[model samples]
Target: MTLLLPPTSEVPVPKFNMADLTARLLAPGKPQEAQQQSSPALNPPDAPEAHEEVRERRRAYQRPAGHPSRQERAQARALAQQYRDYAEAWYQALRAWDMREVKIPYSFHYEPGESDLDFLTLGSNVRTPTRYLQTPAGEFTEGEVGVVITTMSRAPLVEQMQLGKMLDKLRHTPDTTPVSLLREDGRWHQNRERVARYAVAVLTLAVQLRDEGAEGPLRYAKAVLAGAH
Candidate 1:
């Protein structure tokens, strides 16, 4: 029986030129482009250092200092704590009632520290949910009244001056014009008035506790307004 056998001789392949192969592979269609050869003698070593300096300057410009002063940061933290306390008080007051009675949908807070105020606002136009037992007849409302706190300096001169200007406006016109006297004049005067009212309430409560022997009544009122705790 005869069997088919394969040839023993190897087929010779053509050796290609390195430059022609490189031109075919790397520099396909482009004509004789100059190769990017590096020269350490001609280039300055400080080029990288100059580039790094430019990059660092750009980063410095992009990012700024977080807090200018430690004292200012501490004051901000204290103010934030006060705001939390104020919010807790307001929330306690609101949650005292059944959800059916006061369905507070949207409440907003603004820190007007520069304007010497912080505000707790209720959007509803009805009577304020807060009931003042001392409120005269026909003065009760379920809509708007919340509280504002004046974070102004605790100096009598500054307080009196600011309050005096506000009082003069209140006494003279008896109109709620939403304007401020500050150079910045940031917030509406109505908000400032609310904060002033809270300050008055604080003073009134203090005075009553001191002389009128009304500590029990004040406690009861606060309990009623701010729920259990």
Candidate 2:
């Protein structure tokens, strides 16, 4: 026997459009606006421009290369003045130590016409004066002497002779005066190591003098020598 079925209008039919689904799948994807809103911007509107940033860096680099400021110049002048004052103090201390300035006749063999002759003769005997600070301990000379030759009274004979030979090897003009050992030219002398040794010798003498009841100038000299570097 056949069974009775319900009316087609009463049963709702579901619709499936293949063409619309295919079109939607094949269409290009729209920009992900939500993802863009979540991430940070590469160049924010409030940030400085690239050229402006470059200019700022350039200015910072050039600041050091420009002329010194007023404060810097003032500081440099003050430092130079201090050095001069210290040098004068050191000289005064040496004077107080009974240091007598003496000139020794230094003769050397030079070419006949290399310098003006002391005597009108065709000989290689050239006399250049050597200056020394004759102290009770030893003889002291400047760093320009090119050798650290402090001939102490108690030094060995062999050492004294060697120092004499070294002194003889130095060449100088006949009119050259003794250079001060403590004169600072904003830098160390040519022979920095030798100059330092000379300073040490001076400091040692100053220390000895201080021990012998001479405390005032020697103390200042010691301070200057200690900070000479």
Best by lDDT: 2
Q: In every candidate, how many clashes are there? A: 6, 0
- The segments of candidate 2 whose C-alpha lies over 4 angstroms from its true place after superposition are 1-152, 155-178, 182-184, 211-229
lDDT of each residue in 1-229, candidate 2, tens digit only: 9986545443222233344334334446643532222222222223346435434433332333334757889986776445444433333344332334554545545566565755545433545454555443345554422233344323477644543332332222212312444446644355544443333344434344333322433454345446665
What is the TM-score of candidate 2?
A: 0.23
Looking at model 2, residue 200 earns an lDDT score of: 37
- Model 1: which ten-residue window has the lowest total lDDT? 34-43
Scored by lDDT, model 1 comes in at 0.34
Model 2: how far is 66 from its true place, Å?
Answer: 33
Each candidate: RMSD: 27.2, 28.0
